[model samples]
Target chain A: MTDGDVMRRGDFSNGWKKSFQSLEKWAWRTAVDAAVLLALAAALAAGVNAWKLRGGGSGGLPWAGDWDSYVESKALAAGIGIVTMRELADRVPSAVLDARPRELYRAGHVPGAWPCPAGDVDASLAEHVADLDPAAPVAVYCDGAACADSLEVALELKARGFARVGLYPGGWSEWTANGGAVETGETEAAP
Target chain B: MRRALRIVLLLARLALAGVFLWAAWGKIAAPDAFALAVYRYRILPSWAVNAFALWLPWIEVLAALALLAPGRRWRAAGAALAAGMLAAFTAAYAAALARGLSIACGCFTLRADAAAGGWTTLARNAALFALAAAVFADAFFDRRRRTPSPENP
Candidate 1:
């Protein structure tokens, strides 16, 4: 090839190379900016939320019984004992009342748990569980942290003269998540 | 096309930024509450929930800022990131819906708003994702045709 042709080809290639280099440099700048922003946000969030970060799900899942389960303070103050998965597994309560809605209870629940919706806590317990002694222990649960039905049911049970009312704050979600035995289609026997 | 539709693009960018900023505020304020909300989704593994919560809102903040920032580089970067986030959110919401989860959306607020994530959430996020992707594509291709800016890289 002629020197002139070679020089022209080199110029053409250099043009393309320059364009690509410009695009690549722009990309690098954008990436660096994004990285800086992410680092800043991470640092700020980590700094601001350090209190929660240290103990909140940082170590691992909120599993193993102590999963930052947001149990209401009043329930604890009212003498309701918090029941962990370990406790529930070790010693089954005499009455394991599922405080979730009937539909949810039927979907799946802790094996042997009886249907007792939160709204119908008073009447349902009275009607379905009237045969049980008031002094007997009763454990209640609902839909874990997102749910308050368990607390309501526990308080109702407490007022009903159930001396031992254990509150399973983790509820059905925790049970299923931790591979606890699940029962569907309703348990035939009342707890 | 970008030049002709510059006004429309600007408005789209603003709307997405506004949504991101609004969503980020509450989560940033209450990391613990948002963490719990993330847990409720049941889609993310138990371990990643907190870290995901911590990072997501802040990324949202960055994307919003980038969209608002001047310069074509910022615009393209912001749209790309925003599209990715919306895609992720849409997928999470769809998963929750498919799984029959009835938990709070944890979308706009940290107040444990009872408004559940459902088909509506999926649809809205899908729409937002489309907008972001469109904007991103426009920025991406439009840059290819233009001479590089003389500003320092």
Candidate 2:
């Protein structure tokens, strides 16, 4: 057959076959390319996140800067003894801040400790903090290590500019453990 | 034709990359939640779930970035890797559906927002698989064009 005849006769079928083959090849190639793109993207994102997290450590996630700052401030306050946990047995005659529910406090508390549940401390600070001499030490304690009530209470106190706020991290458990004085009544001490 | 194919391939790569990057971020953001999702699938052993949670996102991210790189060979390798992951995910989802298990798909979010007992998850995975397939096809076609053989006659 002449080249022209062959080209015409084979044009449709041959071209169709070649096109199909090309398409098949293209589909396979694209699939491979996409797969690689996807893998690399995932790896980079994960690596960056992991690295940031690793660097963060106990400092907290990069997203919550405010939380980290708050934690740091509390730590500093606690470290400087400006905010500290006072042992009920110490009886240093400082302002005793109880960080338990009022009902729990009524059931019992350190004899001189005042009810200052962490939740209410923020709202009632004007009433409670006013009762204590600004210069006098403020001992904040909660239920125990398992409870973060004292930390919350201390944070509030510090925010309110109470220079002498203290967190008794060991709270009621420590008080009872040390055979500290206890009072069980709803007597509201004058602030 | 080559330019058109390249453009289509690039678009596919971007879409796949975006999906993988989002998935990885979601998992990394809530590793515990991802782990829970993995455990719910009941495919892998409980011990492996945590490790998968930790490493899978990185693998996906690496593959996505590699595909976007300038080197053609590296891009081809990346396409293969990504296709493998998509295939694995598709299989896992398919298996879960077959087992009649209601497991959350920890793809775009750590939170189980999608219905686990339905075809939606499977459909999403299938779409991803299709994209990977397209990428693979493009690379293969490009390679074939470059390496012509006497069989063409």
Candidate 3:
């Protein structure tokens, strides 16, 4: 081989070594940066969530408080049924549930309606229904027709073998707007 | 040619950052609602759901901020993070589809009316995945071309 060709080959080998070394360095640097980014993000999120749960200026997460009373109300009910405000007013023994968070439920709810956050429905429904007959009518509502919590709770009640579960489509907003009897508090006192 | 490629890379980076920032805002605003949405997916266990919801949005925000920062190293790190996040999402969506779960995308909106999970959701995630891949490719593939010359420096 010519002398120039030999030198060119040697140079090519050096170039390959440099490229590989640069790639290795880049990979190492990228990995370290990624670790830092992930740690910072995780720490920030955890801090915010902790603050929120501890009743930060934003008022204790989105909806937190009075879960026990809500569950107790559900347990005390005899049956579940769907009804409008007029129907609810007409039925003497119908058990009412506000299927939003305790905070929203405490703000205003159908008279004698107990808070039942939809998230807790699956876990708490069976115990609540044990106190009631399978055929008793129980009605549940949330924000309004647009909210899905009421429907979800109704389905759970039905699944739990409640014979007469019902969903009040209008929920809290409709009840208040129509001048239906309303109560606001953390207690689940009798209707 | 070089100028055009540089512009393309910059645009891709910005587009990724913008999309992620917009998504992070909604989730961060209503973390409880987002946690419920994540729970509904049934992919992660119940105990993991709230924790995942709490952390995911900040990760998106931080990665987006990094992607927007100048310099190849920062851009590379950001693109990798973005791609990794998209890939995780795509995998989760695919798993949900395979398991026949009816749920919402919960990607951008916390509203109950958010579109139900379906092929459309999968396709949307896949498109984002493609965009993330493009960002990653542009960031890493042209390192030699992007190297500063004495004249440019």
Candidate of highest DockQ: 3
Q: What tens digits encode model 3's per-residue C-alpha lDDT throughout A1-191?
A: 22343254353455666755655666677778878899998898878877877877352243232222332123224344335455666654456767898888777777777667887975445434346675778888788756778777777777777777776655677667666776788545543
Candidates by DockQ, descending order: 3, 1, 2
Q: How much does each candidate deviate at the interface, measured as C-alpha RMSD after superposition? A: 9.4, 14.3, 8.6
TM-score of chain B of 1: 0.90
TM-score of 3: 0.60
- Flag the better candidate by DockQ, 1 or 2: 1
Minimal lDDT window, size 10, model 1 chain A: A59-68
Task: Write down the DockQ of candidate 2.
Answer: 0.08
CA error at residue A135 for candidate 3, angstroms:
20
lDDT of each: 0.73, 0.64, 0.69
Please give, for residues B1-153, the per-residue lDDT of candidate 3 as tens digits: 869967886787888899999999888888866875676566665456667887889989988998997766667778889989989988888887887655577888776434465898888888878877777666554443446231221
Categorize the docking of model 1. incorrect
lDDT tens per residue, model 2, A1-191: 22343354443455766745654665555566555555565565456556757874221123212222333235444642422223345565477778898899989997777788878875655665566666777777778655777777777777777776655544687567656668898446652
Per-residue lDDT value at A168 in model 2 = 56
Which ten contiguous residues of candidate 2 chain A have the minimum total lDDT?
A58-67
Candidate 2 docking quality: incorrect, acceptable, medium or high: incorrect
lDDT of 1 by residue, A1-191 (tens): 22343354343455766756665776676667667777877786666566454665342222122233446445666888766565566545787888988988888988878888977876887767888887777888898866888888898888878999988776787777777888897888767
Clashing pairs in 3: A79-A136, A79-A137, A79-A138, A80-A137, A80-A138, A80-A165, A81-A138, A81-A166, A82-A166, A82-A167
The C-alpha TM-scores of every prediction are 0.57, 0.46, 0.60
